[model samples]
Target: MNKYIIYLIALVSGVLGVFAFSPFDYWGLAYVSLLGLIFVAKTSKKSTALFASFLWSMGFFCFGVNWLNVSIYQFGGASLGVSYFLVGLLSAYLALYPVLFTYLVQRFNVQSAVIFSVIWTFTEFLRGWLFTGFPWLQLGYTQIDSPFSGIAPIFGVTGLTFFTVWASASIFNGVAALFNGKNPKIALFNAVLLAGVGGLSAYAQRIDFVKPVQNEPLRVTLLQGNIEQNLKWDPDYLYSTLEIYQKLIAQHLGKSDLIILPESALPTLENALVPFFERLDRAGQAADTEIVIGTVYQDVHSDKLFNSMVSVGNPNFPYRLETLNRYSKRHLVPFGEYVPLETLLRPLNSVFNLPMSAFQSGAVAQPPFMAKARVFAPAICYEIIFGELVRQNLKNDTDYLLTISNDAWFGNSIGPWQHLQMARMRALELGKPLIRATNTGISVFIGAKGEILAQAPQFVETALTYDIAPMKGKTPYSVLGDMPLYGLSLLFLMLRGMMAFMRRRMNLSQKP
Candidate 1:
């Protein structure tokens, strides 16, 4: 292949990935990123491997996260140069993972089709966990629409990534063989792996792997204020925002058993929420309902603020703020919610220009919050993506899963949809209904099968009311956690290491 052609291939494949995974269509484009890796391996020079990897990553992040321009230029009020610099720096950092993977693969000389598959997948697993762990844009997500999605219930995303890369390498190698005017055996092997991924997915979809017993039916309502982030804190908008939510709740106050609002829907601290809490108590009493609203709660003792979801109105009586169900946001954005390296980077907040960039960390092992009639396991924003976090929250009495996010900052990009897609996977994995309420849009209710039961459109100010049965049964993923998947990965690493050691010994023995 020509030199420039390889670069073009990387760029094209990266763009395709952006399109496929974006909110517009199916997410199969993530698998296409592996193609860029192949291009680097086959055509790029060894010394230039890092450069090739960086270029491929640039293509992926630059296009995939184009929506960042909105937040930076429009929201953060940064200059074009600064915004572009930040995006470029982030892409360069993320690109290092793939570059490191490429370097290791080349060093190992484990080029067999099967070995290569494991090697690629192991790197992805590491990428997800290394450095605070940003598992965004995993190739397995693209296969969600394909038959390969069923494997998520069994091997998790890592296994699907393994098979996807295997299929990619097979097709790339097979195509290369045909171009070189040779036999197509390698291509056939690639086709078989691809077929197998699809076959398993189809089979898994048809089979009822999870048998969740409906313990009781719960009626709920999600309130989406569709309030603009800019004016949310303004005193002028406060009354209207509060009134809008109040009016929306009044409609469902008596009708539904429970009412839900988006993250920070109240936009007030615990002390500041006395009046509203009183009104909610009175309303719940009159209507005979339990209202769970996403509000900002501050711990008076620590004075550490939390993005929390609290429930009001219970059967136990007295209304001095029933401290029932609560979940604080575990994963905060690097610069958005809180600035990292506060001493060093604090100055950059002024230079780079950020909005409300300080937040306190929440306890990881906190107990699940109690609600009206059920116990709610809350995951604020990005916490939903962490599979282990959800699994750890599972308890014998845990009823439904709740995730509240302020996607208003992500704007109208693929960010919200990707979030919704990931949230859906968690529901599927645990065999529990997940209710996600967002500030801007994509507030949805997902069934145990990962199917969308009810949803509100993006960039809308509306309310959704639905009845989902709280489930008691656990899925394979919830019971085993990542133990099975991590164990298999460790086993692969040990076998690979042994094979390498034996090969080295044999080479030494054969020496003159």
Candidate 2:
């Protein structure tokens, strides 16, 4: 085969892998994608393998996260040239991870499927946390709707990545062996192993990791205001935005036990909305309902602003201040929420000059939102992507998980759908119902098992009403977190290293 043709095949495989994720959801394609990687690396020289993998990763990130350019050019007011340049730079940087993976495998001559899977998973873990982490388009996220998703509660997303890569490599090696008319027994063993893994995944779907807590089912209404990012924070549109949400809340006042508005649903600060909150308090007192509104809150003394979720008129407090039951966003997006080096980057473009871009992060150990005699953990927008961070906020008595986002920044891109899918994975991992409210749609209620119970249309002004039974007990992933999976990956690496050492010693001794 032509060398450039092979590289093009690798790139195409990576592009096809994107279909395995949201919107397309052709998950089985992921196997074929990884199989291409395995075949290229096995057949090519070290340098060729490294370059091929880099090409594949470049294609993967370029296509998958192309939505980044949409936000940068459309909303951030960057020039088309600057937006594409930045996107290209990001794709190149992300591609380096695969470069490193391929380089290590070639250098070490790692042929074991177990070792390859471990290295792949460990690299993913590193990518998630390094440089404040971009962690988008993780391989495991593609399996959210696949049979493999059943193991998410046990091993989390990283574990699913490990198993997925392992299965892909195993099948590729086995097929190659059979085609060469050698090692028929090895091919048969690989077939059986693949079957066993699939069988286990299917079986895992039936296992109940958590039970429903015996409480009155909560009737929740998630509101999508469908606000445009350009006008969301414009001072002239503030009154209309507030009125839109206020009227939406009023319509669901008596019908819902809890009403949720998307993040920054109100364009103004909490201090500016005192009268509106007071009016809502009176209405809530009459309706016996609780409202969770997403708005900015300013600290009077510190002069700091927070992207916050404030509960108004909880049955417990009829006329308390809106700040009484507020949960501020702890994890703020690096460039979006607050520029890294504001002193240097502030003057670069309108993106850094975004309104309210310098908001303060809430405390990591802050209290959950209280409503309807239950505890609700709240994550604002980008914070939902961090599994461990979200797990840290979960409590023994926490009844529901709530995430609010204004994805209008992503426009009609795949970014919103991918974000929604991650939220569902979190719900499945925790064995709790998740209420997700978003601006410009994909607002949904996800069940404990990661099923989308109800969803609103994208880019639409609508509200979804659903009854969610709060769950008690914790899933394995919730209890142990990612520690067990990380430990297993480390163990595999150690074992492979020892085996490699033994093989070297045997070869040296046999040289005599």
Candidate 3:
């Protein structure tokens, strides 16, 4: 096959990955995309493989996260060209992960799907770890609806990633040989291997790693204000914003066990809003409702700001005005939460100087907040995407996964859909119900089994109410996280190297 044709196919394959994710959710495309990548990677030359990998990732991120330009241009005050450039630059930066994976695998002369998958998983971890981590649109996320998803409870998203690559490899090897009318034994072996893998994965879906702890259900309300991004940060619109949420909560007051507000729902510093929160506390206390409000908090001593979630009322932990029981956002976004290299970037454009863009991270190991005597693990905005962060916050009795976001920035794009899908996976992976409340809609109640109980429309001012049972058990993922996947990947690599070395030695000895 011609190399340029291969490159074109690689780019298209990457874009195909976009459909494999939320909204479109053609999950089988993920395997097809990987198959194209594996076919292109069957090259003897290193540059060809590396270039194809980069093109593959470029198509994936550019199309997958193009919604980013909406915020940069429409809200962040950047010019249209600049916004597109910025989005491309970010996509190009992410593309380096696949490029690096290709380089290493090619360098080591280990050109097999199993080896590539191992290296691929490690590079993904590096991408998420280095520079505050952006684990969005990862290949594993595409498999939430596929049979591969059953493996997530065992090893999280990375487990699905490993198998996606391996399965694609098996398909290519088996199908290609059959087409070429060559290597009957090899094709037959892979056919049987794929059958076993599929059978076991389907069986794994029946296993319940987590169990119910209580019979009683907790009534919950998620508030979506749908306030436009411009007015949300304006001090003039403060009372109006508060009133919108106040009315939403008032409707569900006595009928709910918990009420959740979107991230930064108040749009003001916590100190300045004490009287307002106090009023909310009184209402929640009277109604027997626990209100979890996303608000900004400032440290009086240092004047540093933090994005935080406070327990307002009706909780096992009593509400305090001065020092509220809260979960401050720990995983701050690189540009969204805080600008990197502020001096140079801030002067470049108005986009860099967005309101409350420089909030400090909260303390690590912050305990889960309580609502109606049930423990809830909290993740704010971008923090929900990191599986490790969510895993660490879980307690033995944590009953729910609570993630709050202000996704108005993405506007009416696929970004919110992808974000919501990930939130569902977190619930499925841990066997805990999820309460996701977001500004500009997508508020949802997700069951412990990863099923959506209810969801609000995008860009709509609304609320969702569900009587969700607080789950009590943990999934295997909850017990042991990505450590198993990491160990297994390295083990496979080492065994592959040993087997390859033995083969070469045996051939050399047999030479006459």
Candidate 4:
């Protein structure tokens, strides 16, 4: 085969893998893509394999997250040329993970499937938190609807990534052996291994890790304002946006137990919207309902701002700004919520000048907001992607998980759908019902089993009203988190290294 042709195949395979995710959801494509990657890595030289992996991941990130350019060029006020350049730069940087993974595997001559799976999973885990973590388009996310999804509650997304990669490697080895006609037994074993794992996963889907709490389902109303991202912060549009949400709340106030609003539903600062909040609090009191709304809150002492969700008209607490319960977003988007290396990048473009771009992160260990005697773990915007962050917020009595996002920044793209999928995974991992409200669309109520109960259409001005049964008990993934899977990966890597060393010693003795 031609060398350049191999690289092109690798790149195309990565591009094809995107279809396995949201909007497309061709799950089997992930396996085919991985097989292509394995072929390139095994056939090429070390340097060629490194380059091929880089090209492959570049294609993956470039296609998967191209929606980022929408926010940069259209909303962030960056020039078209700069937006494209930045997008390319970001994709290239993310591509390094695969490049390094392939390079290391070849450099150390690590041929064991266990070692490869461990390294791939560890690389993914590192990418998630290193440099404030981009963790988007993780391999495990593609399996959300696959049969492998059954193991999500036991192992979390990282575990799923490991299994997916391991299975792909097994399939590749089996297929290659069958074609060569030199290792029939090995090929048969691989086939049986793959089938057995799939069978177990199918059976695992029937297991209920968490039981429904015997409490009455919460009657919830999610408000989608469909506010334009460009006009969201304009002073002129503030009152109109407020009025739209106010009317929505008024309509649902008496009818629902809880009324939820999208992130940044109020464009103005909390202090500026005191009167508006006061009125809503009065309405909530009158209707005997709780209102959870997203807005920007600033600290008077430090003058620092935070992206926050505040609950008003809770019969248990006063509507006072200081006394009202709130959950401030902790995981902020780099260069979106706050710019990194502000001194260096702030001068480059109007992108860093976005409204609330300098917002501060909330405390990591903040408690969940209480509503109607039930605790709700709250995540704002980009925060939902971090499963451990959500898991840490959950407690023994936590009932529901809530995430409010302003996905209008993504415009008409797969970004919002992917974001919603991640939220569903979080629900599945924690065995908790999730209430997701978005600025423009994709607001949904996901069940404990990660099933979508009800959702609103995109770019629509509407509200979704539904009753969600809060679940009790914890999934094993929730209890152990990702530590057990990490440990398993480490165990496999160590075992492979020990076996390799023993084999080396035996060969040396035989030669002597």
Candidate 5:
């Protein structure tokens, strides 16, 4: 096949993966996408395969995250061309991960499924970690609703990613070998391994890893303020935004044991909003309710500002100006939350001057919020997308996972749905029920099994109330967060190195 044609096919394969994720959820396309990349790596020259992989990932990211343009162009006061250029630039940079993976596979002539997955795991990990990380659109997220989701509790998302790649390679190698009337033994082994993973997943799904804390569920209300992104940070409209959420909280105060608010539900700095929060604290105390709400926190002691969430009421936990009863977001979005190289970039564009974009991260070891007799580990906005970060923050007694986001930035785009999907995966991985409250919109109560119990519609101002049971016990993933996968990956890496060295030796000796 022509190399350009191969690259196009590779690119199309990646584009297909977009439909496999959120709002579409055709999970099988992930396998198909990997198969196409595998074909490119196997059939094309090393250089061509590496470039083809880059094109493939380019197709995946450009279409998958195009919603970024909505925020950059519409909200950030940037021109359409600049928005497109920024998104394209980010997509192009991310595509490099797949290119490195292809280079390793082609250079080493890796055939073992384990070795292939090892390379894949490292590349994907590096992509998410290097330079504050952008772990969006990982392969494991597509399997959240699939039977393979069962693997999450054992090995987490990276494990599911390994299984996906392993199974795809098994299908490709086994079917091809069988058709060629060769390597029957290898084909049988691949077939059995593929079937084994499926069987294990189905079996694991039937077994309950955690149980509800009590027979009676906790009455929880998730508030979706549906505040417009443009007006959220406006000083003129801050009170209007606060009033909307205040009304929502008032309506649910006595009725629900816990009322959750979206990220930045109140757009003012925490220090500036003390009196307002004091009223909320007093109201919740009077009603015997606990409220978890997101806001911007600027410390009085320092110039530091944190994107934070705090709980009001439940005498044990009071609304405070400090980090007490608070979970400040750790994983801050690069340009969206805080501008990097501010001296160089801030003056160049309005995108860098986005309202409330200059914020610092909180401490890494902060305790989870205690609400309504259940412990909750919170992830604010972009934090939930990082599986390892979420895992690291989990505690032994964590009952429900909490993430509050403001997705209006990507208005009416698949971005919100995709964000919700990743949150579900976190719920699945930890074997814990989840409370996801979002601004404009997608407020949801996700079950411990990663099922959506209730959801508020997008762009709607609404509150969803449900009696969510707190879960007890730790998922294997909680006990061992991706360490097993990394161990296996390291072993595979050493094996591949030895194999490659032997192959070179054999080639040099046979040259005579």
Candidate 6:
């Protein structure tokens, strides 16, 4: 086969793999993508390693996250050319992670192929954590429907990602060695070892923690309120937006015990929502429901604005103004939510013309939302990806996980599916039933075992109603967190660096 053709096939295969594991299919495209990268990298000449890595990453991100075009064109009001350019730029930036990983792997002439793979994973693990973490495309999320998902409970998503990369790299190296007419015995043995470890992971998935002793189900009405992102900020659309959500709630008001809304469901400013709250409070009172709606609230004490989840009508306090069961969003998006290096980036903001160009960060240690007898752990949109953040917020008695997001930004891309995949990981790791409310679709109710019990289609303006039992059982991840994986990954990186240094020293000594 022509070398150019091999590289092209690898790129196409990687792109196809992304679609397979996406919402359209569950055949493990994520795993295939990682494997495809290794194959592509293997075909490259040593001189072209960096270029090959870049090409693989570009193919993976550009095709996998093409949904960014939706925001740039549909929401940001940019032209097709501009949207394409922006998407390409962002994907290229994401691609750098794989390039850096491949670069480091080549520098360390490690004897064990498995060890090399682990080092590759250690870089990926760091990419997901260091610098507020952009774990958008972690490999383990692809295993959501695979047998290996069971490993998540034992070792968070990072560990699973590390293991997947390690195994894939080992197999790739072993196969290449065989093709090159080298002694295939060592490679064959390592391949068998990888298979054995993978089988163990499959078996481990069957394990479950103790079930909740006394399960109390929470009847949740998740509202999608599929509002147009562009019109959401328009003052004229405020009443219509408020009416649409109010009407949706009216239909299921008495039917559900707790009603939920997507993030920033209130299209108005913080102060402007006071009147809307009065209406919601009255509706909750008349309909006999406790409501948790997403709104922007201004904290007078700190003079800061927050993306908050406010509660309306606690039945116990009939006459009292309903207090907020607020969860201020901790993980704010870089350009969309808050501009980093504000003075420098603020200029680019006007050029790109992003909506809500700035938002303040909320305290990480804020208390969980108090709803009826249950305390709900909340994560706003992007916050769901951080395993440590979720683990930290999980109180011993916190009954369930609640995430509110506006998928209008992601549009009809694999981005929503990727987001859903990551969220499911949280459900698996913590063994908690998750209630996800989104604007413009994917309003879902996920079981503790990471099963999507119920969900609404994307781009559909609808409310998804479901009842889930909030169980109190902690999975291994919930108990131990990512501490072990972090320590091990760090040690591996240090060891790789030390090995590289020793190899260079040995070469100098031998030459003398």
Question: Which candidate number has the best lDDT?
Answer: 5
- For candidate 4, the 10 contiguous residues with the lowest summed lDDT are 315-324
lDDT string for model 1 (327-353, tens) is: 777777667777667778776645343
Cα lDDT computed for each candidate against the true fold: 0.74, 0.85, 0.85, 0.87, 0.88, 0.76
* Colliding pairs, model 3: none
Better of 2 and 6 by TM-score: 2
TM-score result, candidate 3? 0.96
lDDT by residue for model 6 (124-232), tens: 6667766676777777777767767778888878777767777777776777778888898968887788788778888777766636545566778888888888788
Better of 2 and 5 by lDDT: 5
CA RMSD of all predictions: 2.6, 1.6, 1.7, 1.1, 2.0, 3.2
TM-score of each: 0.92, 0.97, 0.96, 0.98, 0.96, 0.90
Q: Where is model 5 poorest over a 10-residue stretch in terms of lDDT?
A: 315-324
Residue-by-residue lDDT tens digits, candidate 2, 239-285 = 88877887788899998988888998888888877888888977886
Show where candidate 3 strays beyond 4 Å: 179-181, 315-318
> Alpha-carbon error at 401 in model 4, in Å?
0.6
304-402: candidate 5 lDDT, tens digit per residue: 998988888777656678747788888889988888999999999899998888899989999767888778888998999888888878887787888
Q: Sort by TM-score, best first: what order?
A: 4, 2, 3, 5, 1, 6
Instruction: Report the lDDT tens digits of candidate 3 across residue range 105-195.
Output: 6778654657778888988999998988888988888888887678888778888888888778778877777888997887788778777
What candidate 2 gets wrong by more than 4 Å, as runs, is 318-324
Instruction: Score residue 364 of candidate 1 by CA lDDT.
Output: 76
Q: Best by TM-score, which number?
A: 4
